[model samples]
Target: MADELVKAGILSAPEEIDKYYLHGSGHFIGLYTHDVGEDPDNLLQKDMMFTLEPGLYFPEEGIGIRIEDTLLVTEDGCEVLTADIPKTVVEIEAFMQS
Candidate 1:
């Protein structure tokens, strides 16, 4: 993730990556915004519910992007529960204009 951002010129040094880290990629979301039971180091399994939120904070430039989606682990891949949300810039702009 950091590598991709760096390649795009959004970030400079690799060490600067920590500035955008959100203290963990994501967390379980159930009864609360941040549910419990999932371990960061453990492998994912079927039926598990969690979030995939990668955020970048370029405070100096007043730019930040954090996109989150609830996911359900499956046999093949995963299902996005928030798929209906307009996440892309163009989508967001269109939605907002409506």
Candidate 2:
């Protein structure tokens, strides 16, 4: 995620991002980012689903955006669940002003 953001000039470097962020939103979405699913030792078997939702918050820029996508893990590959939210600059501005 950091690599992609750096390539797009959205972030100066991966190290600029904090190591951890409080999940103030919630955790019922899926397996917590910390992988504390009541049984941390449990191994992912099959049909397990999760999310990789890291965010960047820059209060100086009045920008607090989190790019999240729910994923379905299978034996073959994975699938994105939240692919409808707009992430572009114009889209976000319109949304905020609206």
Candidate 3:
């Protein structure tokens, strides 16, 4: 994401990566409601549920964009629990107009 931000000319240097982008990868979701977070050393195994959210905040431009999705790890891969919902700028705008 930092690389992409750099390519888009959002940041002049890699050192300024955290100036606007706040927050970590995401948190775990369970009966505990955010307990048992993801461990960097361990790979996500089957049955683990979590969220993936990547956001960008540009206060100077008065705009902040965030996209979040819930996922469940499976034997083959991960299942996007929020797949049914509208995402992307076009999809969201169309859904809102409807």
Candidate 4:
């Protein structure tokens, strides 16, 4: 999740989730939710990129929180691509209020 955020230019650094298990281990996202959007045998190249989403869905708790972002694999490092979406708590509150 952190990788995705940073690549999208939302965060300046990486973040560590204390409990990532309850909140989705991870996922491979793209044009399709279950299938790979890119080539099947596509390898991680110098400018490769992908999405890393970690989420927690507790229907009983009435809470379904998922953090997703697209990341670009560059020669030097990675880059985020979904910074346009509001994922922060404050941003979410503001959006809901609007």
For candidate 1, the TM-score is: 0.82
In model 4, which regions exceed 4 Å deviation?
A: 1-43, 95-98
Error of 2 at 53 (Å): 1.0
- Colliding pairs, model 2: none
lDDT of each: 0.85, 0.62, 0.85, 0.64
Per-residue alpha-carbon lDDT of candidate 2 for residues 34-96, written as tens digits (9 for 90 to 100): 454435457654566666676667666776667777666668677666666777899879889
Off by over 4 Å in 1: none
- The candidates, ranked best first by lDDT, are 1, 3, 4, 2
Q: In candidate 1, what are the lDDT values of residues 1-98, reduced to their tens digit?
A: 88887898867977779987756778887789898856777998999889989887877888888898899989998999899999999999999999
**Model 4 C-alpha lDDT per residue in residues 1-98, reported as the tens digit of each score:** 66775687745666533333364344455456544545646666665556678774545567767687877778877777787788889998999999
Could you give candidate 3's per-residue lDDT for residues 42-97 as a string of tens digits? 89899999989878788889998788899999999999999989887799899999
Report how far off residue 89 is in candidate 1 (Å): 1.3
Question: Against the true structure, what is each candidate's TM-score?
Answer: 0.82, 0.53, 0.82, 0.52
Candidate 3: clashing pairs of residues: none
Residue 69, candidate 3: how far off, in angstroms?
A: 0.7
Error of 1 at 17 (Å): 1.1
Query: How high is the lDDT of residue 97 in model 3?
Result: 98
Q: After superposition, how far is residue 75 of candidate 3 from its true place, in Å?
A: 0.9
